[model samples]
Target: MRETREKVQLQPLDHDLAFLDITTEWDLSSSYHDWRPSIAVPATFVPATIPRVIAICNQKGGAGKTTTALELALALIARGLRVRIVDVDDQEASISVWLRYYMDDRPEELRYNLRDLYFNAKVKLSEASYPTDFENLTFIPSFPDLGEVDEKNPVGADTCLQRRLRQGADDVDVTIIDCGPRLGQLTVSALVAADDVIIPVKASSILDMKGVAALQKVVNVVKDTLNPDLRIAAAVLTDFSRSKMTRRIGGSLARAYPDAVILPARTNVKVGEAQLAQQPLRQFAPRETTTLDYDLGARVLFGLGAAA
Candidate 1:
């Protein structure tokens, strides 16, 4: 059967960049028709090592949570470490979409495999794995059905992932969980399962204070009730612009959370554009400003330069 071709113009933000998709019978082809061709380099040529899991979470929406998750996942994978992501947001499957486009725009030789893990109380982690184009990266995707699981199982819902983390999550070096915008049962489960958390705070807004407060509350609760080892490894600053107010909040947050690292604020359009195409910033614009920010953030969290 022949299928009709439809023009899909994807513009993630109000930028001068876009992507075109051509669909044919049993086939699809795409290219960066509007974007400039940029080559991405491997992540610092690190030796073979075990991966680690970091959860990029914040209660405030529009804080670039998923972008942080996917960008870091792709950056780490490019560095030759095996990485996987668990997307816990059922309402907005943003990471899931990015992985799909990432798989699409590849040379078939250097593509990383991405997978998704949906919320299933009864299903084991072994059953949720899916293969992607990238070699070192896999994803556990979340869907709307996850909302059902969240609603039906209230008490034990948050504990499900904790059980899976114990039973599984040791195969790879890193498992990054992109959490929802609010403190729900799923967020609780991710905290219980995670060894560390990466909170991205958008600077220049008092609105972020609420997220910080909520995050701190959860951390205290989890440290007391659940996993004592759970630490606030880093609180990254995102979407930061150059101004006195920006520097003020950035400095304040760094002081308030002295243990956490406050990396520089990167305002890159390529990051948003990649998200619109469901692609990672590294894959779309590797040398772009956003990718550079992610690289630095990864280094700090991974403790590459800091004294050990």
Candidate 2:
């Protein structure tokens, strides 16, 4: 058998394959600089049998929602599943901008986007779902103007995304929606659209943990009034390295969402370079330890491997 590298064993909330720990050590043995071991993934596990609509959500900005969404989607695609990713956040920093390889810099130059699907009924979901460089992965870009939906609060605004995605993304095995920070119509729309919500929090910030309260409040309201089946599926602690604070956050997430998976996405500074290049970390920096974290996260969530 191969020698083991893990310093500590992490127990998942359940028997499912999920990465609950976020800490890793730097490789002292290597000539190169690398985060040594990825959080353990199980040797075997049953993956999801049906398609999933997962929303990457967090009310706190810079908490890693976009990173989780795009990286997880890429990981799923790498597993040979057809994936459709929707960038619902309209900010310049969102996936809508980072994922502009197939899209024009000028939002108006694009044929279709969130502005078309959400603001105007004439545009169909398929029209906005664009093909990406990857074979099995598709992209749906959102522009700055689309943020108006939060302000306009159009008729059936909350349910509109669910309806569109259900109708448009039916061909894909997984659909990941990257949500903007803040509780409002846009976030509500994503929650309403998703069957599962994956919340990303900064491991170092207790303030980010506090933001979950507001998100959970909104989620409770969504469950009561709209999508009763909606669930908080996972809490991903990003920028994670082992520390007293990270362990505390992980434990707190575990206690709060007893039935949900808690994962740590170990930090990689190369993430920004990947984003600037407008490529998923899987493609840009496949060897990066943090990319491995997202890959293992995808497998764990989908049951692609056994729990470690």
Pick by lDDT: which candidate is best?
2
Model 2: per-residue Cα lDDT over 119-162, one tens digit each: 77888888787766666778888878887898888888889988
Clash totals in order: 22, 8
Candidate 1 residue 72 Cα shift, in angstroms, is: 1.2
List the pairs of residues colliding in candidate 2.
42-306, 42-307, 42-308, 44-306, 45-305, 45-306, 47-302, 47-303
lDDT of 2 at 232: 76
Candidate 1: tens digits of C-alpha lDDT, residues 1-308 = 12333322221221122211111111112232332211111233222224455677889988878888877776566555667788787765557665444343446443322112223355656555444556666676666556665566554655667666556657677888999886877788889888778788786677886798888898789889987877776666677665555556655665556555555446777766776776667667766666666665564566443121
What alpha-carbon RMSD in Å does predicted model 1 have with respect to the real structure? 13.2
Clashes of 2: 8
Q: Evaluate residue 228 in candidate 1 and report its C-alpha lDDT on the 0 to 100 scale.
A: 88
Any runs in candidate 1 off by more than 4 Å, and if so which? 1-51, 100-122, 306-308
